[model samples]
Structure formats: C-alpha cells, structure tokens
Target: MLPTLAQTTALIRHRRSIKPQDLNPARGVERELVVELIENATWAPNHGVTEPWRFHVFQDEARHELVREMERAYREVTPAAEFREDKLQKIGTNPLLAPVVIACVMERHGGAKIPSIEETEALACALQNLMLSATAAGLGSYWSSPPLLDGATFRAFLNLGPEDRCAGLIYIGWPREGLNWPRSARAPVAEKIVWRAAAGA
Candidate 1:
C-alpha cells in the first residue's frame, strides 16, 4: 500500500542535511540498507532512460581513500601559499565522521536523445530520493554542495571518465547523541508562486 498523503508530506518536510560532524562515527550504516538507499535513487525519473547517475560508496577505513583523494585534489588546485592546514584537516577527517560516504557522480551521455541538463536534473531527483530514504530510515545524511566538489583530479582517482562530473559527496550515519536539529520553517508559497488562469471564454 502507498503511504498516506500526511506520511509522505511529513517525510519530505523532515528530510534535512545533518552535518558530518553531527554524525556518530562509532556507528555504521549497514551494507544492506545502503544498497536499498541506492536502489531508491535509481528509481528516479530520467528522460530517455539515460540513467546517467553513478555512485561510489566508501565505508569504514575505506572512507579515508576519498578523504585522501580530496586532499590531493585540494593541493593540486590551491596554491601552496593559499593552502590552509585547517581546511586540509577537514578533508582528512570529515569522511570518518560519517559511517558512509557516497560520491555522487553525473555522467554526460554524449549526444543522447535528451539534453544533458535533463540528465543532470534526473540525477538531482535521484539524490533527493536517496535523501528521503535515509530520512525515512531514521538516519541523518548530508550532501556537500561546495562549488568545487571533487573535480577532475579526484574524478580520475575514482576512475571516472574525465568528462564525467563530480557532483558531491553524501555522508550518511546516525546523528550524534547531542546533535539536535532545530525545527525548520519555510516562507509562504504565495510569495513564490505565480499562476495564470484561462482568459474569458
């Protein structure tokens, strides 16, 4: 049976990004649940069925691999004079804060029937699905939205084609004991929506 409208709406509204530092490092997201989350992501709608989203999952000690690659990428891009040790420290330790880190990738299917933007939007929907799944599971997940998320260097480290895009990294885990999320509020939709009715017949 499908979820009731109230249940569905509540799930959507409660889904929020929990920062990596707010996650419990000692706990781990089970492998089976991770697979289920990814399955939910794949069910996202895609034009022409391009299915252009790809995921690289890192857990346990393996999550360090992503951190290491990210640090290297930072070094490659940021000049030594401008490099901040504190930022590199976060790159090295942040992934360890979460039980799992999923590297979100977007592959551009060259000359596909639909525009690349459609595929990108499909990927966004897929990420939303995964996030909602995590929320429903009572797990906290964070998706990094940095402007320069793992770029070419880190993509090559992940063995992705150069043309593929490094969207972001999703950190998933249980919230730490003291991690309390404040109630979230949204502005009235009336300020944002503009609907036009039909002209007089």
Candidate 2:
C-alpha cells in the first residue's frame, strides 16, 4: 500500500545507511514486500512513457556467486601493496549479510523521443521511489556502486547490452540497529526558488 504524503516525507527524512553487518540475519524481509516495493518504484515519473528500469535480484545462494564475482573484480582493481586478505574476505562476505541485493539497471532506448539526460533523471526518480518504498516497508536499504563494479565487466556479468547502464546496487535487509542518525539539514527553500515579474508592469 502507498504511504500518505506526510508518512512518506517522514520515511525519507529518517532513512539512513545501515551497514550489512548491522542488519539482522533472522529478520529477513518477505518476497511479497519486495514485489510491493518494485510496484511502487514503477510509479515514478517517466518522460514519454519510457519505462527504462530493469532489475536483477540476488538472494540466498545467488548472493554467494555475486560475492565471488565482486571479490574477483575487487582483487583485480586493488593494488597488491594495499590489499589485505581480511579486507578482501570482508568485501566478499558483506553481500551475504543482506537478504537481497537489487541491481538497478537502465535500459536505454536508442533514438529515444525524449532527451537522453531526462531518461537518466527519470531513472534517478525511480531509484528514490524504491528507497522510499523500502523505508515504508520497514526494510533498511543501502545504495552502492563500487568503482570496480561500475564498468563493462559488471554489466557483462549481469547480461546488460551496450545501451544498458548500471544505475546502482540496492542492499535490503532488516536493520540490526535502531534509526539513530541525525537528519541531514537541507538548503533554504527561499534561496533555491525565484519569481520573475514584467518590468514596471
């Protein structure tokens, strides 16, 4: 179900990045809620009715393969001097902590009627929708795009074409810790808004 405006705003304000380790293993989110979240995500505004978003969901045993791929990519990019075995292990283990990992992708429509940049902006809005839905559903989510996994290698692994772009990875699970972070302050609305009038009208 969709949250009311006030409730949605509150969720947005309270959302924070809960670490993978900080998530509760026994308190996984149900598949039904995940479907609801994706449904809500589709409500985001898209210019010219181009629904460019695609998702690759990873959970349970699938997560192990993802971690293995990510570890391989990480090792390939990391400098040998700075690479620690423990850190690599942690990197591989982190994804397993989350019950689900959502790979958000943008499927580009070549020769799109709308501007290309607007399509990307629309995808950003969809991403926010997903995040807000997660919050409203009582699931903690962290959106991340590691540099090593941002290129063709990752896209190929996920079976994305030349036009498809990897937006980010949404890590979803139950929060182990309470929502305790202070809300980030926003810029003054007056400074951002302006009005124009005819001269001497």
Candidate 3:
C-alpha cells in the first residue's frame, strides 16, 4: 500500500544529514537492508530510461583501501600551499566511522541525446531516495563530496569513464548511544513558490 500524504510528508521533512562521526561504528547495517536501500534508489526517475547511477560500496576493512585512495586523491588535487593537514586527516578517517560508505557515481549512459545535466539530476534524485529510505529504516546517513572527488586519481581508482563523474560518498550507520534525533527548520514554502492561474478564470 502507498504511504499516506501526511506520512510521506513527514518522512521527507524528517530526513537529516547525519555525519559519519555521529554514527555507531560498531553497529553494522545488514547487507540485505543495504541492498534494499540501493534498490529503492534505482527507482528514481530518469529521462529516456537511461538509468545512470552506479554505487561502489565500501564496508569493513575494505574502507581502509577507500581511505588510502581518497587520501592520495586529496594530495593530488590540493596545491601544497592551500592544503590543510586537518582536512587530509579527516578524509583518511571519516569512512572508518560508518559501517557502510557508498561512492555514488553518475555514469554517462544517456549519450549525446540526453544531456549530462539530466543524468546528474537523476543521480541526485536517486541519492535522495536512498537517504529517505535510510531515514525510514532508522539509519543515520551523510553525503560527503570533497574536492578529491573531482581529482583524476580518484576517478581512475573508481575506473570511471571519461564522461562519468562521482556524485558523492554516502555514509550509513546507526546512531551512537545517547544520540538524539536532530530537529531542523525550513523557510515557508509560500516564500519560494509563485502560483499561476489561467487568465480570467
């Protein structure tokens, strides 16, 4: 059965950006649940049915390899004078804090016919779907996109094609002990919307 409008609205509004540090590293999310979340993500709309999202999941000790590559990419991308030791350290450690880390990618499968922006938008929608599903499952999730994602070293690590692009890294895990569900506020919808009516209706 479909969720009621109120339930749906509640789910969307309740979703929050939970950071990796806020997650419980010891509490592992089940493989089946992870697969279900990704499956829901695949249902996101795409123009011309050209599903363009790809996920590279890093879990357990495998995350260490991801950290190595990320650190390498960070060094390769950042100029010496502009580089920060703190940022590099965070890149090396963040993946280890979450049980699951998904490297979301926007693969260019729509070709020249469908614009690249459309494919990227589709990936963004898919990520939202994934995050909402995670929220409903009581999982804390964070989407991290650092400058290293744009580096050639990282792209080559993922074996992405010339036209493909990494969207972000999604960290998924349960909240640590005594962690509270965060509250957030949004501007009124009326402020952002401009309604139009048929003339003289």
Candidate 4:
C-alpha cells in the first residue's frame, strides 16, 4: 500500500543528518538494503535521462584505504598556513565510525546538451531520496563534503573522468544505543513564500 500524504510529510520532516560518530560501527547495514536505497535514489529526476550519479561504496577494510586517500588529498589541496592536523586526524577517523560510506559522484553524460548544474541537482535529489529511505529504515545517515573531494588527488583515487564531479560522501549505519533522536525547526512558510492569487480571485 502507498503511504498517506501525512506519512510522507512526517518522513520528510523526521529525516536528520546524524553524524558518523553517532552511528554504531559494529552494526552492519546489509548489501541488499544498500542496493534498495541506491535503487530508490536512481528514481530521482534527471535532464534527458542522463542518470549521472555514481556511487563508490566503501566498507570493512576498504574504508581504511579511502581515509588514506582522503588524507593525501587534504594535504595536497590545503595551504601550509591553513592546514590543520586535527582536521586531518578527523578525516582519517570519520569513515571508520560508520559501517557504510558511499562516495557520491556525478558523471557527465550529456556533454554540452544538458547543463552540468542540472546534473548536479539531479544527484542532489538522488542523495535526498537515499537519505529519506535510510530514515524510514531506521538508519542514521550523514552527508559530508570536504574540499579535498574536489582535489585532483581524490578524484584520481576514485578514477573519475575529467568532467565527473565527486558530490559528497554519505555515511550510513544504525544509531548507537541510548542515542536521542534530534529535533529541528524551520521558519514559517509564510515568511519564505510569496504566493500570487489566480486572476485576482
């Protein structure tokens, strides 16, 4: 059966960006569940059916290699005066805190036909779908976008083409025991919207 409108709205509002540290590293998300989430993600709209998103999922020992490459990229992109050892350490450790880390990418498929921005927007929509699905599945999800992801070192590590872009990294796992679900608030719709009446009706 399809979900009610109220159910859909509730799911959207209930979705939260849980940090990797809050995720239970010992609890593993099954491969089938990951595939289901990604399948839902691909349902997101794309211009001319470009279907540009690519997911490189890293788990188990693979996350270690991912962190090593991330550290290398961070060093290569950051200036000497701006580099932080603490940030590097965090980068090296964050992936291990979650059971699944997905490197989201937007591979250019439309060339000059479809704008790159639209492709990126599609990828963003895909990620939103993925996160919503995770929320419904009682899983915690986080999207992390470090500047190092844009660096050539990391792109090369992911084997991305020149036109492809690494959108972000999504971490997924069960929440740790005794963790409280976070609550959030938003500005009133009236403040953000300026609706116009139809033909002075």
Model 2: lDDT of residue 149: 64
For model 1 the TM-score comes to 0.92
- Listed per candidate, the RMSD to the true structure in angstroms reads 1.8, 2.8, 1.2, 1.3
Residue-wise lDDT of candidate 2 within 1-201, one digit each (tens)? 966999867888878776677677666678888888887887889887788788888888898988877887777777789778997788788888888888888877635477767766778898888888887677788888776566556767888777777777888998876646434687987999878788897
lDDT for 121 (candidate 2): 77
Per-model CA lDDT versus the true structure: 0.85, 0.79, 0.95, 0.96
Q: Which ranges in model 3 have alpha carbons more than 4 Å from their true place?
A: 197-201
Candidate 3 per-residue C-alpha lDDT over 72-131 given as tens digits, one digit per residue, 9 for 90 to 100: 999999999999999999998899999999999999999889999999999999999999
Query: In terms of lDDT, which candidate is stronger, 2 or 4?
Result: 4
In model 3, the worst 10-residue window by lDDT is: 177-186
**How many pairs of residues collide in model 1?**
0
Model 2 misses residue 194 by how many Å?
A: 3.8
| 37-100 per-residue lDDT for model 4 (tens digits) | 9999999999999999899999999999999999999999999999999999999999999999
User: How does model 2 score by TM-score?
Assistant: 0.84
Q: Rank the candidates by lDDT, best first.
A: 4, 3, 1, 2
lDDT score for candidate 3 against the true structure? 0.95
TM-score of each: 0.92, 0.84, 0.97, 0.97
Off by over 4 Å in 1: 79-82, 147-150, 199-201
